[model samples]
Target: MSDLHDLFLTCPKGLDGLLLEEAQALGLTEARAQVSAIRGKGDLETAYRLCLWSRLANRVLLVLSRFPVSNAEDLYLGVNAVSWSDHLEADGSLAVEFSGKGSGIDNTHFGALKVKDAIVDNLRAEFGKRPTVDKVNPDIRVHLHLDRGQAVLSLDLSGHSLHQRGYRLQQGAAPLKENLAAAVLIRAGWPKIAAEGGALSDPMCGVGTFLIEAGLIAADVAPNLKRERWGFSNWLGHVPAIWKKLIEEAQQRAEVGLAKTPLWIRGYEADPRLIQPARNNIERSGLAEWVKIYQGELATFEPRPDKGQKGLIICNPPYGERLGDEASLLYLYQHLGERLRQSCLGWSAGVFTGAPELGKRMGIRSHKQYAFFNGALPCKLIMLDVEPRQFVTGERGERSDAAPAQGAAVIEQARLSEGGQMFANRLQKNVKALGKWARKEKIECYRVYDADMPEYALAVDLYRDWAHVQEYAAPKSIDPEKAQIRLLDALAALPQALGIPTERIVIKRRERQTGKKQYERQSAEGRFMEVEEGGVKLLVNLTDYLDTGLFLDHRPIRMRIQREAAGKRFLNLFCYTATATVHAAKGDARSTTSVDLSKTYLDWARRNLSLNGLSDKQRLVQSDVMEWLREDRGEYDLVFIDPPTFSNSKRMEGVFDVQRDHVELIDLAMARLAKGGVLYFSNNFRKFELDEGLAARYQVEEISAQTLDQDFARNSKIHRAWRISVR
Candidate 1:
């Protein structure tokens, strides 16, 4: 074999260009960038250099042969043509890694098996003994790629991925990959910043991946310096002398780099449990003195004054793909933006996030944006100049002044806008009118505003002293930008009009939801506030869900249930959080049974019952309402059935469309009714129509108009209610 070898370096997707530059800088000839991999030529020493120093390459492969293969037989012949004894001993262990698909090779595992069989057969035919396969730890590791019937066979020079680096023995949840972290640093211009003796900090560093990588880059330390083994270690072409010389030279360079590198690197994590792992990783990387990890919250994180000013601030905050993450994360992103504006002025900022909209919520416009992939999810690496000028000149090219005059003028203008002022003035009038009615009725939670002005489409509800604002999804005919501007104006005027702190205002976008989306968790904040209405205390989480635990629109219905349930046994179906059950129990019902399929809501129902001093007589059942109705044998004098407009939950047997299945649902609940019993059926399906035939057999009165309270008078179609009894 010649000293020069064709090599293929694989890296994370979207980093091919960076890997190409690194490979060429390492003296690899004819380097060309490909999608997620780079093709180049390097000798034994060049390959060793990459294995030791390349921070962005996942694996460095030494290509041994290439041929056109059309079938499994052709693959076998192509692989068998290589002299197996020249690379691995006949009695040694080996493993084959197969990738891609081509003619007659669809399964990667089968292709790997065939490649293994060819190698073993060739070695056995030459030396009368075949190498045993070692899947865990092998003496020789081979890689085979099949693309459009062309095969490229290579040796896996790096035993494990170069990103492993033998440093991180402990990691936190979703720790950024080391190579990807390095790529982010490079894209953020960290190399130039470090060369100029600038500092770097990661506010939400998880297990110190970015901190350690940045430390290595700043200190000129080889990424794989501590790696004890490689695929070439036991290969027949292993050269100990050349490897030792390269190690010595890298050590000398690292020593000189560490001594004069005036760069400071620090990281902060809110999780105390992650601090030790970060310290352990930094210590193992021989950068303990350079990288410092502090257990602190983002709200309190600040750059160390001793480390100098105006370097780089980079973080990979939670992208929040899980349920209920986006709601709570909005405030976090807003806070991060404020912190940058206040404390990190003049510093460069890099924020890599999977949720780009959430990044936009930061309010700091990026000067440059790069696309990258974190696993399968495409993400953006946003770079911002965290200076006064950038902060003042926002994404809209508008000037934001720091003086109180400018702020007050902006607020005054928003409050005086033709549409905004009318909405604000109407809100004040409603507050005045409702204030008297609420005190007389002893209602602490009620709707204060419901799109009084059509241009400002929002529903503002007061929960005790707090305000919960739900913005209706705008129509496609309206300009979204204009709608957003009006929303901002409304938000600005709400606090002054309602006499509530801005922090007390919770906002959510309300669109038509189907299936189980409305019931799904929107945030994990678990923040709940206690509010009272009609002498009933209910728990409401304004920020953690689409709908607050208690339905404000159903206040009259619950009050009616309380008035009717003197001594009768009551049943509440689809009893979300059992707010009505609390009312029925408080109204002296004999016994109450609440049925729903969600265990979470059932637990919530139990809590609500407990909160109101209700008794064990009120039982919460977790079962599909349809199935429960089929098995129910107990008779009830009063029953309330309020089904969702639509539900396709996996726990349910089939889809439930209220419009299509209302008759069946009504019949099921009516079967459990006693003689002279009343069943109150209601739903929010706007287009609901009653079956005339059933109304003829049973007395059904449309009492929807009577159910509307003064607050919901404007939107009488919010829900429909009916009182049914046996004729």
Candidate 2:
């Protein structure tokens, strides 16, 4: 083996340029960038320097032999040609990582096995002993790449991928690989920003990846200074004196950089559990003095005034992986954009996300967007310069201004047009009329506005002092801009008429939903408020979900449940948040069983039940309602079945269409009914037609009219109810 050898420094795709630049800076000769790896010529010392200092590399590989091979026999001969004694002893352990396909070596595992056989056979012939294979923590790590009948064999100089900086002992879900994090920081211009004494902030930092990477960059600290092991630690070709000198020099540079670098770095995570891990990672990285992390929500995240006005705000907010994540993430992205526009003026902001459509919801134009991959998932890094022009104006022409006076501008701009005035007048009238009835009924939550005007197209509900607005999705025939203006007009008029702050008003677009769409989370804010209805305290989350915990139109139905629930065993089917179950429990029912397919809502029901001290004799079961009804043998005196109009949740064995499945669902519930039981079935399918056979089989009465309280009088078709009893 030659002392000077061809080398390759591999990195994640899209980071080849950065790795090449770092290799050149490290004085490697003839450096050239490949697809995801950089090729260079260097000696053992140069390789050691790259291993210790290169932040963008995943591994540093020293090429041993390159040859053309057509079959397994040829592959074995090519592998045996290398001098194994130069890198590994016969008694040492070794491992092989093979990749690519060609030349009759179609399977990676088979190719790796063949190469391992060649190495062992060569060593046995030369020294009558062969190295044993150790998959983990091996003394020698070898890599084989095959393409188009050519194989390139190399020795892995980094035991693990260089991305494992060894500082993070713990991390949250989907933590960014350290090399990828370094790439994001470099692309965000963190090094130049730090050179200019600028600061860095990550408002939604989960494990402080960005902050730690930024700290390392700002302080000129070697990326692997704390790493204790390497692939070549026991190699015969390794030079201990040269490696020691490099380590000492890196330590001296880090010491001076730590003292002289003036960089302000901070991270904020909403989850308290993530805070301690983030702190631990930062401390382990030896950047504790330069970085700070705090537990906080994004709504209150602001740039530190003392840290100056310019810096970088970079974050990799959760790229929702589950079914319900997109809806919830939309609001989070919107809030992030708003915060950037309001508090990060004169700074640069970069948002890395796998869901680019969610990024569009930010309402800010991006200056640049670079495509990269988070593992196999293609993602984008959106870079925005937070200038005045980047601030998006709302429908009322309210721009995000950093000054306090900007809020007054928003309120002042909230004026009503002639149509808007008429809409506002109608809302005021309904509030006055409903206000009286709500006070008399002791109801703190009720529908105050229900698309009173066609142009307005909104349902406004009052939850105590808070206003929850659900905008009806406008028709495709209407110009989107016009509909947006009308929405803006309605949003502005609500706060003025209701005497509430804009922050207290939560808005969601309500369209006809199918499947599990409606149950999807809209945000992870978890901001719940306690509201009283029928003298029961219920937890309501207006911003986190499409439907508030309690349905305003179902007030009379719950009241009826309370009236007839005394001394009876109550079963609430499709018990969303179990608000009716709470009413039944309050009504002194003998026992209550709430069944729903959603564990999230069941947990919410548990909390609501706990809030009212109604935990005894109450069971919250997570099961498919239809399946549960078929399997349940226990009898109940009063049963309430309020199911969705259509559901195709994977949790359910089959599809559920209320109009089609109503009779079957009723029969199943009726089978579990007691001798004098009454089954109340309800749904919101507007064109529902009751099965005439059900009426003949049992006593059936349409109580939908009675179920509509005064608050829901304007829309009696909101839900239909039927009372069934055995004849």
Candidate 3:
């Protein structure tokens, strides 16, 4: 064998470019990037150095042979050609890992079995003893890749994955892998920050992954310095003297780096149980002098470094994946943003999160964003320059005065007239009461003031920061002059009471529309904003339509569908924007089909699906729901049909009046449901009632009380829903 060898270093997805850069820096020649891996030419010593210093690599493999393979026989012959004795002893243990699929073998388990059989057969013929199979702590780990009629074999030189640095034997519920944490730190510019003698802090640090990794980088200590076992330890081709020299050199560099002025690094964790574990990890990494851990709440978290210090504030906040998590996470991000603006002025910050939408609520603009993947979940690292320019001051929530460190903003409350004061007080009371329930249930869009007093007959809906106010058309008996005067008073008190900007309040007239007039385009401004519910993203435009595209009263219905849609087929009829189907698809539904008569809403539904990356296996049909139901033959496990109160569109064959046509629509939808399947029917008409005869035809239960969330509790007549099932 030649001194120069072919090597491949595997890494997590999105780190391929970083792995190539690190490999070349570690003396791997002619390095090239591949999918989640790097291939290069390196000598044995170079390979050893890379295994020791590579912070982003998962494993390093040394290629032994590449041969053409047509079928299983060719794979066996190709494996038998390599000299097994040169790598693994006959009495030693081995493991086989096979990837890719081609030729005859279509499954990875069968391919691995065939390769193992060939290796054992070859060893038994030569030494009269076959090696034992050891999946854990194997002496030799052989890997095979069969692709495009060819096979390449390699020996794993780093033993287990390099991400297991052995320092963190215990972690929190969700721990970032060591290699990925290091990659996040590097991308966040920790190396450059450390070189400038700056400090580092993680406010929500779990078990010190970021702190220990940052210390290792700053101290010039190899990430695998504490690892005692390696794949090459028992190999016959290993050189003891060359490995010893590399270890000595690494130790010297580490000692010199540690003896210098230590960098100020600290971690604050909310969980008291995690503080000790984080401290233990810091001590085990020999970074006790440079790092500290404190049990602190995020509300009171204030990192204190030496005076005249401006450094990086990096944190990996929890990106929860639950139905009721967005509302709480919105506040959490806002609190972090408030802290950054209040306490960490002139410092840089990086917030790594899988929930990028919540990150936008932080009220700061991240100048740079880098995409990465944590196993399969894609995430983004939002890098912020914590200067005056990065603080978010948009038209929705403009900061009128200098931001006060204590709370959200420092807006001077406007002086209210006698009537406006009462209106503001009433609005403030409703916000205080509803905000708590909103956070508890994760309700983003809600009705705040629904004409509590007859004098001010307007309904207000809060969608995140923007407020949608619809003035109810008054009876001619009430003076029109007084109604206008009250509206103007409410407008004057809105910005102060709600703590939002005047430009974000959308006012519209809510009159009784004559036929299909409600469906007409209200405006063309097209200012769409994204909102989250049940862990799915939805697009809503307040100024473009009469409705915001998401009905707050139907949130519970959508969440139930999201929870029950795994591996099931889902259908939506009269699907305005297909928001419920979006939730179902995100819940891992096998397939989704949405039917509607409006081509405009179908196009909007397409955008909603694509936004959440749920476009695969989702079908959108632009046809009237009744007509489509008659022609469609596909069966569905879950169906949702929420029709308008009345419609007389030119596109439809006939009029759709819920009071007159609901029974026929329900029967048509029930025909498409599979046995033991569910179909949810709802309508906004206050007096709408289900046909009494249909209950005898199918199992039906009224779920209106259960479907009404806290936001719509006051207005029980907003909508009514039913759960119909096949008997």
User: Clash number for every model?
Assistant: 2, 2, 0
Per-candidate local distance difference test:
0.86, 0.87, 0.86
Ranking by TM-score: 1, 2, 3
lDDT of 2 at 105: 88
Off by over 4 Å in 1: 259-262, 392-395, 399-441, 447-462, 465-528, 541-547, 567-571, 588-606, 616-637, 644-677
Which portions of model 2 miss their true places by more than 4 Å? 1-3, 294-309, 322-344, 355-365, 394-443, 447-462, 465-530, 534-553, 558-680, 683-690, 698-719, 723-727
- C-alpha RMSD for every candidate: 4.7, 6.6, 17.5
Better of 1 and 3 by TM-score: 1
Candidate 1 backbone clash number: 2
Which run of 10 residues does model 3 get worst, by summed lDDT?
407-416
lDDT of 3 by residue, 374-448 (tens): 889999999998765566664243433365556433423324557767888998999999999888877778888
Per the 3 Å backbone cut-off, how many clashing residue pairs does candidate 2 have?
2
In the predicted model 3, the residue pairs found to clash are: none
Lowest lDDT 10-residue stretch of candidate 2: 406-415
Q: 1-727 in candidate 1: lDDT tens per residue?
A: 2478999999999999999999999989999999899998988899999999999999999998999998999999999999988899999999999999988899999999999999999999999999999977899899999999899999999999888998999998888899999999999999999888889999889899998899899989999988998989999988888899899999998998878744789899999999998999998999988999998888887897484556999999887655334344655766687777767867899998887666665656688999999999999999988754455333243444443343222211111345556677889999999889888888888898898788888999998898888888899999987886687557656777888866788888888998999988877889988878767788888888899988888889899999999899999999999999999998999999999999999888888888988967998889999988999899999999889989887788999988888888888888899999999999988888888777977899999998988888888888999999999
Q: Is candidate 1 or 2 superior in TM-score?
A: 1
